[model samples]
Target: MITIGELGEKIVATWLEPQNYQILHHRWHCRWGEIDLIALDNHNSELVFMEVKTRKPQNWDQNGLEALNINKQKRIYTTAQIFLSKNPLWQNYNCRFDLILLTYIIRKNNSNQGLIKILNSNQIMYENYIFTIKNHLKNVL
Candidate 1:
């Protein structure tokens, strides 16, 4: 059986398809890190690099979209750069970053719902898991 995380992505990708987006890559991993999905909108002539997070509950660090941190973003960006370098076709394409946060839910009746939440954030370019992105406790590091 496919894992719950994979299942969640399948559902999300399906939803993104009819919207006129072409899926270019999935689970693209390298020595630096992994990028969950890469899609392109041929009509708009834009590229979308996506990161996905899967969880079982509302248990994030806080009530904010800080699940993916600075360190992670840096790795993702580097991976994207490398992908383009290898695939010159996307070299001049305008690109944007996206985040897909999916929550895997379970029910009492042995059934569950795959709740997929999509967030589009280009501000976060790195990962800071232990602290707030706008500010930091200097001594903590």
Candidate 2:
């Protein structure tokens, strides 16, 4: 099963794809840490380094943006530097950091003995799940 973090990366990647962003990496890691998504913004000719935060609707106190504290931001910035060093092709492009916060809500379906039905053919114990982009902040760092 895909973890929540992985799912969030995919969701953000999908959202960016339609907006003229070409994904270069997902979960790119270095000695510092992992960057959720790295892409080339075709529309702006910039390299984008993104951090994604995923949480249940009830888990966040003041939106997920608060989770990207100073230390986390520093780590992400360092990681992006390492990435650019390794992938020199993007070194010349302007770079920017972004944050994407996703809120996921899962609703219980008690109609069929706790089974959630979908499309009248698929049934899942965990169903009626919805994901929304609670925030997308560009140039976060």
Find the candidate with the highest lDDT and give its number: 2
Q: Write the per-residue lDDT of candidate 1 for residues 9-123, one digit (tens) a residue.
A: 5655655676688998888878877777788966787888876555555555532237667887788889989888888999999887876655544434322234333323211
How do all models score by TM-score?
A: 0.68, 0.82
* Pairs of residues clashing in candidate 2: none
Reference-based lDDT, each prediction: 0.59, 0.78
Checking candidate 1 for backbone clashes, the offending pairs are 69-126, 69-127, 69-128, 70-126, 70-127, 70-128, 71-127
TM match of model 1 to true structure: 0.68
As for model 1, its CA RMSD to the true structure in angstroms is 9.9
Identify the candidate with maximal TM-score: 2
List RMSD in Å for every model shown: 9.9, 5.8
Q: How close is candidate 2 to the true structure, as a TM-score?
A: 0.82
